[model samples]
Target: MKIDARSVARILREPGALRVILLHGDDSGLIRERARLAATAIAPNLDDPFRVAVLDRDAADRLDEEIFALSLAGGRRVVWVRDGGDSLTAPLKASLARPSDTLVIVEAPGLASRARLRALAEAQADCAAIACYPEEGRALEASIRQMLAEEDIRIDPDALSWFAGLLGPNRAATRGEVEKLALYAGRGGQLSLDDVRMCIGDAAGVSLEDAAFAATAGDRAGADIAIERALAEGTSPIAVARSLLSHLHRLRRARIAMDGGQSRADAMRGLRPPVFFKRTDAFGQALSLWTAARLMEAAEQTQRLELECKQTGAPDLALCRRHIARLAATAMAGRRR
Candidate 1:
């Protein structure tokens, strides 16, 4: 079965008949977090060596034989496969032929639509495929509130709205910021906008987003500073590249909508997951700067650079830096005309 984002939390809590689930998407952080949550739901004592068995990507062959064996600890057992790749496909197919009561969580990066493992899980009645894309709009807001509520921390409405704009779409980073703010606020303290700015600052993915947008918006100096800050703070080059790709895709869609007779403002408003409230105006500005053709060119260039970064001998960080700089320079030079 395939489940929507809204159904994720509920399904994790009451997984009914789901015996195996494949959590895969571009958002690796969210995928891992959900895998952890699913593991908790299935085997609360994750620390127990026997109750939960983790099979890493390289050791995937073991799962082929491991799944048929009963757990020594018994009761409830969980078999987790992390960073699943093509290597595990045959093993998984064989194991799924006979459904075991044990819950199996397969964590993988975005799978193609015709991916064999993804298809297998989705087709099985006792399985589910959940995509863990970045949280946005209502889902992002709900996640903030839920995380805060757990810590008994209260945030002012405006503060929440401010955070809504700055929070990283990555679940792990977003949760970390929430936890940091919770501790900063102490118990039962109401968090204010200033409190958030002072506490979280550019650390919670603001620099990364700012760097991507500033580059596209033709602000080279700003993008340079933001990019530097983001890298210094440990954001990965691939993460920055992915963010740029996502923004470019959105720009292309907005441009397409405008060409089809919709006003730019209307097109922006129609965006699903909706642009962040704080980013609406800036995104509108991006639409003016990047035509659909230009955005497509940029997307292709970035995609190639991303591939280069992932290749064996490349200096990923340097290549990523060059890509962002070139794009920013290109955007700025075009705008001057």
Candidate 2:
């Protein structure tokens, strides 16, 4: 059967009579984490040779034998298939055809929806298929808070919002960064906005944010430098373009709020991912210079730029840089006026 997120914790903890569990998704970290939980539920000591079998793609030919073999220690066994795919589908189907106490855990990151292995797991009465994906918005924030709470670390609300915005979309990378932050804060420590900045401000996302803010604030030199650094740090041009577009969209919303008679400070404070304290001045400047109509035009152009970058053989880097430069120039002209 196919398991949803709501039942994932219970299924992993007490997978009663479940012969095979397939964990598949784009989020490799979540896939691995779930696979581990499912495996450990059957075989407490994953390193025990008699009770556990770890198979890579190359060693998948021995899967049937591993599944049928009885454990010498007299406990249930776990066969963990790493990098699983449709190639192992036949073997898995054959093994599931017979009765066995061994639990088979398949860790297949990037598995397609219609994959044969996934289909078998979902259709079989004694099997399950679980999809793992990255968390976003409130889900992402809740995960961050939960991870930090595990270490008894408290974070300010503003710090949590800013930190969530800065985190990458991947669950594993986000976990690693949060782990680093927890270590920095120590047990029972508190994290302020300044604490988060001191810990994670040098990340590539920060540079991208810098490029976006500088472009919108008419700081041509600063924007150029930040864009170059961000790309050099392995941030994609598409990501950079989206970052600027996101900033523009936020500015457009703030401008709308201003039109509704709200003060600039209120509008800025009302942003979902609250503006970082250090960028308040630049954000305010961008808000003052950009009217809703002009912001809308710039956003439309950015959408076009994103589409162009997605085309085959397009010079994405150059296009992104040129577009950012144009935005900076437009802001400069608005400032001059």
Clashing pairs in 1: none
* Model 2 agreement with the true structure over 80-174: per-residue lDDT tens digits: 99999999998988887788988999999989889898899999989989988867668888889989999999999878877776555467778
RMSD, every candidate, angstroms: 7.5, 3.1
Please report the candidate that would top lDDT against the real structure.
Answer: 2
Candidate 1 error regions (>4 Å):
202-223, 231-337
The residue-by-residue lDDT of candidate 1 on 1-337, one tens digit each, is 8888679888877776677889988788889988988888878889876778898989887886666667787766788998987677788778878857777788988677788888888888788899888776667887898889887888877677657655555778888888889999998788977788678875826788788888888788888888888888877676677777877887889899999999988998786546666777768877778778989999999889778876877898888788888878878777876
User: What value of lDDT does candidate 2 attain over all alpha carbons?
Assistant: 0.87
At residue 213, what lDDT does model 1 achieve? Answer: 81
lDDT of 2 at 68: 97
Local distance difference test scores for all models: 0.80, 0.87
Error of 1 at 144 (Å): 1.2
